[model samples]
Target: MSVAVIGMIAGMALGFAGYFGGFGAFLLVAALGAVGFVVGRFLEGDLDPGEFFRPRDDRRR
Candidate 1:
């Protein structure tokens, strides 16, 4: 249930995907995992959509 354990399992699955389906599969799986992690964080309220898209203030202006 921990993040590290989830990541390890994902890594292992992607490794198998690469072995059977080649580099393209590996990249696809990795991309999917990245997207899933982001979505999960957002849904869990660990990530804020506003903060992600907020503009930075120029202190010198």
Candidate 2:
């Protein structure tokens, strides 16, 4: 599946969610989608959890 197809499906899902499930459901789906994307990236080893939580070593001397 291409990125465009994934985006289209996601858009359609959000549209259906907004049209039928209302704004709250739309937000919930969007948030969950974002979390899922991140988790997927982590699972694929394309994302580094430490990148987000690790403290910067560039502290001013």
Candidate 3:
């Protein structure tokens, strides 16, 4: 399936979880989904573990 479809499905899942469960459950699902996506990218060799720990140059004077 396309990314859009997958995204839609995930949104629906989150909505159902929130409706049937509660706000806490919605947050739980969203957080877990993010972690799962990160892990999947790692496993697929698309993301480097080092990048997560690496610092950025967002600081300014």
Instruction: Give lDDT per model, in order.
Output: 0.91, 0.94, 0.92
- Model 2: CA > 4 A from native: 55-61
lDDT of 2 by residue, 7-39 (tens): 999999999999999999999999999999999
Residues 1-61, candidate 3: write the lDDT tens digits: 8999989989998999899999999999999999998999999999998887766975656
Among residues 3 or more apart in sequence or in different chains, the pairs in candidate 1 whose N, CA or C atoms overlap within 3 Å are: none
Best-matching candidate per lDDT: 2
Give per-residue lDDT, candidate 2, residue 52.
Answer: 96
Error of 1 at 30 (Å): 0.2
Q: Model 3, stretches more than 4 Å misplaced?
A: 58-61
Top candidate on TM-score is: 3
Candidate order by lDDT, decreasing, is 2, 3, 1
Candidate 1 per-residue lDDT, tens place, 1-61, comes to 8989998899898999899999999999999989998999999999998887666873554
The TM-scores, one per candidate, come to 0.81, 0.86, 0.87
